[model samples]
Target: MLLALIEDSLEREGWKGVSPMEILEILEREATLRRRGSITPNDVRSVFREVKKARETPVLETLRKNLTFALPKLPVSRHKVKMEEFIAASKNMKLYSDQEKSREIMDAVYLIRPKETRQQIGGLHEIKDRILNQISLAFNPRMAELGYDSNCRFLLLGPPGTGKTLLALVAAAENNVAFIKVRGGELMSGASYHGEPERRIKELFGLARQRSPCILFLDEADAIFWGGDATSNKLLAQIKSELSELTSKDRIVVIATSNKEELIDRATRDRFEPHVYTVPPPQDDDEWNEVVEIHLQKIKPYLAPDVEGRKITRMFRRERILSPRGVAETITEAHRLWASEIAAANEVRAATDQEKRTVALARFRADLERIEHMLPAIK
Candidate 1:
């Protein structure tokens, strides 16, 4: 609380609009951060919108302009190549354009790599196989006409750290498709002049359509699409309408993920073909052991005597902990802390043995607690 008050006082000036990353940093420092997360593509989109709004604020306009100028310019040849590619395709459907968004969508898709596949994504072999097979059929023009009775749409519903987003990433990667992620809550800013969100939706879907064989994923698929607000609901309708019209793999594949599928609208729910529930960590004893072994393999290379980071994972993997994403994050953070220790170590000053022990212990304890919280909600 005292730290929060200090952070609150540290704001530059009155009505200082902050970017989403900055807000997260302050919240983490104040120890007020609550939500567990993997920062799904949807969340990134939401944060992008928030930061866009902050940049548009009059107080920060100059700062935003400066930031844009300081950033390295995107390659010119790539932009022209995408423009030519989209233009060639646009000839088939008169609806496409080379607007601001056409470039944005092209740039976004360009960042997607073919190498991001299910083979690289850890865990869920059976679920991955099932989902992949379904997508494979769905992606084929011949199978869509077979009158298969399956929910064409899917919901990757599960608790935090269960690799829901990772599965979506792998699916897109394997399918050789672009992943267009949209966040629901960030779609609604205010009723007055937030038509921008609606426009963004249209452009996003249009781009998906234009770039056939792409995946449209709504990360927190339940938030704004619910039937509570009139305008926001209409925005969702814009999405469903597009999805309903799309018939083949050539027409963009739709994959939606939500932690809470029950809250999704019944009618809206029908649009999705199969609602696959992601199984969280099992209560079975052996599963957590697998997690520990996988992560400890990564940890072993980074550990040092100064940190006293003896691997507890070698003895036991008792707790049903460490989902694939959890393992990745743990490794990343451990590396970060160790790098900090190395950087902080100098002839001028060194961490006391107790200081290093306290830091190391806190990290290990946090890792265990995260595992505890990530246990599967099933038997």
Candidate 2:
């Protein structure tokens, strides 16, 4: 009842959103509800102050973000912002003093790249067109010339294992900007000395600004930004808070991805309107067929004869074409098997004094057939 009264007081004050103090209060309440130990008062005081400073920190940093999507759209010229300026600006904010933690974050950012960068990233012609179109439409006229508008916010929603995260890496590489990725599970830094999710959220946005023009991609976006998870409300608050600040005058941008859209908080959903949705490789979509072919074409040349035989045989005998991801896996497995067989054949030849390519070829073919049976049928 005490907690309810406090929430009501905030609501009555027109605090439609949660504030740093409110968040701290909620954390204390939650700990009690769960019968967990209480949050330390010292930690609460420290993190709440950090939270206040984070208020002025930019979230959108670019006019193209969803927070400002309703504002007049403008044409964006092609230009990339320099990383140095971004880093210098972050230092001004004094957000990241822990260089070690920042490096760890950056590593995760790089590691999130798609396994097949060339094939997946380069082949996204239509998607690129859509993304560029939005960037053009969403930028501010003057900022576009200054490269601020070049930073864009995009929300990618689609089936599982799709290259949503991979697309982020490709975009970063193509634009030559830092790629930073944050997942819902890893957002917390074990609570500050104050136990608020405050410190990490502040650090995250600060890191993003430092890496401005960079891709801040999230894998399970719904988990972080959706309503219903009292835990997620903190992040949801951070998103609105950041975007509001970024719109005033900054060049940083943000992009997010989620497989489940329905679970997203209304505020987050509103912010990502007009987002691009990535559909799973269609059952019979011609475009998907072409993408599949292109992916296979690139991998075909160096298939190592044994792997080439196994994969090609499976593909030719079966009617289904693998998703770009699936095809890549199939090729890798085929290569390993082929390499093993060649090694065995070379060893046997030392004793038998017989070098026969025909027998080896037949064995590879049989292996291919076995592989064909193991693959699940794609619809």
Q: Which candidate's lDDT is highest?
A: 1
lDDT of 2 by residue, 1-379 (tens): 2233434434443333344334534544443343322233333333333433343235324544546447553333123322232223222322222332443343333222223343554244557557644543443356656655343557787766555666666555554444566776565434434425554656566656543444566667776677665556666787767655654133444677777878877777666556646645434344455554555566576553554333453563384544546655665675667666555445434434233444544555544444444432300
Give the winner by TM-score.
Answer: 1
All candidates: TM-score: 0.55, 0.55
Q: What is the C-alpha lDDT of each candidate?
A: 0.51, 0.50
lDDT of 1 by residue, 258-374 (tens): 778677877777777555566564333354444545555566766655432224332334333345456557667767765654443331133357667456445454343433443
Cα RMSDs, all models: 17.7, 19.1
